[model samples]
Target: MTPASEPATATSLPIGSDADLAWVRHQVRQFAAEIGFGLVQQTKLVTAASELARNTLLHGGGGQAKIIPLISGPARGLRLSFIDTGPGISDVELAMSDGYSTEGGLGLGLSGAQRLVDELTIDTEPGRGTVVTVVAWATGVPAPRPGSR
Candidate 1:
């Protein structure tokens, strides 16, 4: 049986810096490039991370973000995850949908993030917290599994 073709991995970065959002974005871009991600894709992914990180700070009252290198399916890649223990999103599906936003938010919304990446996953509960994850490969490939990762 052919199990799968996973590739090499680099170190992951866990972040929590309210005043260092730009630095965080820079790190993501540089690391994504190191992981073989192209320039345009790197911009999208980094921008997505920036949005999520900003939400964590502005909406969630600050939290944590992590950049994880993903080595799977014969391609080099990286994963960015933003998590917060603050008041969770009330409506996940609605929030993820385009043109949906609460009164105070920027209204650019999570849809942009979803559009920027190859794969995206989100989990949230009203009072628990929110976790947003994005995965992208070196090439602009579609997400291999809908729910596996």
Candidate 2:
């Protein structure tokens, strides 16, 4: 397992159009499988990727995602970061709430994606953009991080 302070191996993919959405999902599934993720774990990661990719296209106006394979203190995991340059979210807390939606969506995008992963973090500036990062471990529990609950 990689040391806690070491960076994991990572790859970045651009998400600019509708076609890229499918491609992102495919890439995520392929990578997850390559790293020995089980079928259910792969599905969960893929579903979260799909939702984030769609949000990038429809709301963020296009962005990119980075996939990182991780190992820390005996835990093997995958980390994904979705970044966009469109108008940022105004109310991150509300956006992360389970029943909040501004586009008539079922209001499950952010919260649902959060539930599917071991850890989720979001950073946004109202006029700048948004960056959401999620991580899932093969063991279904993340290694404890300093200052995290």
Q: For this target, which candidate reaches the highest lDDT against the unseen true structure?
A: 2
Write candidate 2's Cα lDDT for 59-83 as tens digits: 8999999888876655567788999
Error of 2 at 54 (Å): 0.9
Each prediction's TM-score against the native?
A: 0.79, 0.87
Look at candidate 2 and give me any clashing residue pairs: none
lDDT of each: 0.73, 0.83
Per-residue lDDT tens digits for candidate 1, residues 3-112, read 12343443444445655678779889988888778789889988898888887776676777777776555456777778888789997877877777665765765888
Instruction: List the candidate 1 regions with Cα displacement exceeding 4 Å.
Output: 1-18, 103-106, 140-149
Task: Count residue pairs with overlapping backbones in model 1.
Answer: 0
- Cα error, residue 3 of model 1, in Å, equals 15
**Candidate 2 Cα deviation (angstroms), residue 14:** 0.9
Q: Residue 100 of candidate 1: its Cα lDDT?
A: 72
Q: What's the CA error at residue 132 for candidate 2, in Å?
A: 0.2
Worst 10 residues of 2 by lDDT: 1-10
